[model samples]
Target: MTKLTSLTIAEARAKLRAKEFSALELTDAYISSIEKSRTLNAYVVETPELARARARASDAKLAKGEGGALEGIPLGIKDLFATKGVHTQACSHILDKFQPTYESTVTANLFDAGAVMLGKLNMDEFAMGSSNETSYYGPVANPWRRKNSNATLVPGGSSGGSAAAVAAHICAGATATDTGGSIRQPAALTGTVGIKPTYGRCSRWGIVAFASSLDQAGPIARDVRDAAIMLKAMASVDPKDTTSVDRPVPDYEAVLGKSIKGLRVGIPKEYRPEGLSSEIDALWNRGAQWLKEQGAEIVEISLPHTKYALPAYYIVAPAEASSNLARYDGVRYGLRVPGDDLIDTYERTRAAGFGREVQRRVLIGTYVLSAGYYDAYYVKAQKVRTLIKRDFDEAWNKVDVVLTPATPSAAFAPGEITDPVEMYLNDVFTVTVNMAGLPGIAVPAGFSEQGLPLGLQLIGKPFDEETLFQTAFAIEQAAGKFTAPQWW
Candidate 1:
């Protein structure tokens, strides 16, 4: 019998096809792993019975020769996605008892593709914090650590739990949403491969809104190939979500080993800004050199708007988040506190239910969208976002793909950033891609001097996941396999 921890999605499928393993057995293996690693706090809730039932059904489909690529694979879903009947808290007290009647379109699509639901993973409350500490459920511990170092380092957020769970080998892959640096940041911190598919590639119908314009759902997996397989299944055109693109989904796995010979890889001069750590700068340069040696043509490019991305994103994201989160008043789903009057009830409920960081973002968002300041802040931010996107469009005209550092530094200790603005600066390299609504992927490139994992991001044209995956796959081959934390 093959142990589940060592298996990949492709390997698991092969075993199932050979009748060497049953879906029930695979589910049991994952459930057992989750039980053994309970201290990691990867999952906010466990739905083993639901998973097993789905696994049995998947086995039946396989028996009838009706299964697809992801048939019977147990997967973790980030709590930000609304899973019908599952407590889909965005790791906040505000949504403590909130359960949706309908599943998120991305979640529903994954189930339709034969993926069994493992459970919802934890995240930063309202997806606001870079570190997972802001989560009402508590911080998710990093799976990796140096020999003498403590194990309490952050797993990264707001998709921290998803990355930790995958790194811990609890699931073959997990669903993740990236608004700013959520998915890729966590993946980088935990030594996993995560891709933020082209904005609008994955449906956002039932996903808990963060920054509406920047939020995109993608897959976090052990490797690029697994991430690509999961992404193909998760993407679709949903009539319910107006933002869902009408384009046909490409077969992402078809181009796995596609040659990158003569492919133009743009190196943005602005990514290595003044504050970048020396180790990270060296890693980025090393990665570029490696790619050049692999037959890729590296060219220097300028995305002059890079400096404005962080500030523009902060203004735009919070402004949109403020608008999207307005539905959480006392009446609807979420928490409601009884009070003296209607106004008091709304104020009391929000104040009591929301976390400090969530409240902070709400205030920032509210202020930016306030009556007198809308044009000065929100409107100007939108204009800057347009310039960021235009920068990519012009660069893509010269190069097939752009390569840059996913983050300025490696994962930091939880609570290391006392100042909120300083913490927000962590997403500088990643926010621009979201602002531009383009696809970006973070793959493990190397490790820092402190032994923390470093990630290289590949940004591609809109709806051009094929090129993105092809480029990442080549990098993966060059980087070799990433080692997970010894806790596994």
Candidate 2:
């Protein structure tokens, strides 16, 4: 018999509907896999009982042929999402043991589709780090390691645990968010598929905010087809979230295997920065050639404002984070440290609750939003953001979609990057999509010399994720699937 935990969501869904195995059996396989893979620290909490109950309920629905699209699929929810009566702390000390009374719109959508919860996954505290080291729960080790080396690598972040869990086969898929490069970067590092849909494509009402304007929920999955399937079930408009778009969610999976003949694929010159890894550059070239062979018209384009995207993203995201996080004062539901007085209590509580990375970002956000610096930093960054968007708007006139290397290099060992600025550069290739409020997907395309996975990113026009899914399928088909050696 095939290892139940090794099946992709698409395979599992079909087999589940065919009654080859009950949902309870599938859920048990994952629960057992997760228990044995704890060395990766992918899951901060495991809800086996909850998952079993949901799975049994799904089996009942399936027996009557009345279940939803995700009918029996088990998924990991990023800690940043609110799961009612479950741990939803965003992996931060500040939000210690906090469980929301309400469910995030994305997770609710998944559950409504009959997906089972596998518990909250770890992440960078407040979704504030390029690597997962900033999480109060500690870093998630990437399932992929270097060739012939046992040193553990980071799975990228702030969606590290989501990516790790999927790559490790502990979940069929995972709900992840992208503020800058949270979802894509981690997916790239871990040899999984992730998409950061266009801003406002999904509701954010129950998600713990990092940078409200930049954060968007999507899915991390074993492959592009699985990602499309999960995203369809995850996206929906909600009255509770004013930012949620009123547009209809399309069937993304339907577009897979579609031909891309004459489709204009843009290659941005600015993306080929100096000192790019040779292996990554070679794979990127091969990706274009693969698309071109399939009749995609490769066009060289320029997004001049992309050079400023990283700095602008840092400024804009942190500024929003500081304002959004202000509500976490000691008086609220989270952790509180009593002090001499109310003000002292607020100060002490924050000082104690926030992790170092969160504190640094909050301070940076506060400083940039301060009266004297707001105009210089925040306003200027906003202007740069507009230019970045304009750059994409211009590119759309000449191309159907844009392609770039997902990361500068492959996954690195934790603690290899110490300088904050150096760490920020990990997102240089991905932050522009968030700045432009566009949809982007990362597909595993190749491997590094060290034998770690590498990925390519596809950026699409707003609300044109169908094109992204179709094109990513092309890449996936050509490059073939990558699987980490099962060391856990």
Q: State the C-alpha lDDT per candidate.
A: 0.89, 0.94
Q: Report the C-alpha lDDT of model 2 over 1-488, residue by residue, as the tens digit.
A: 99999999999999999999999999999999999999999999999999999999999999998899999999999999999999999998888879899988999999999999998999999999988999999999999999999999999999999999999999999999999999999999999999999999999999999898899999999999999999999999899999999999999999999999999999999999888878989999999999999999999999998889999988999889999999989786889999999999999999999988788888999999998999999999999999999999999999999999999989998999999999999999999999999999999999888898999999999999999999999999999998888998
Model 1, 97-182: lDDT tens digits are: 89889899999989989999999998999888888989999888888875467757888888999999998898889999999989
Best by TM-score: 2
Q: Root-mean-square deviation of each candidate, in angstroms?
A: 1.2, 0.7
* Decoy 2 TM-score against native: 0.99
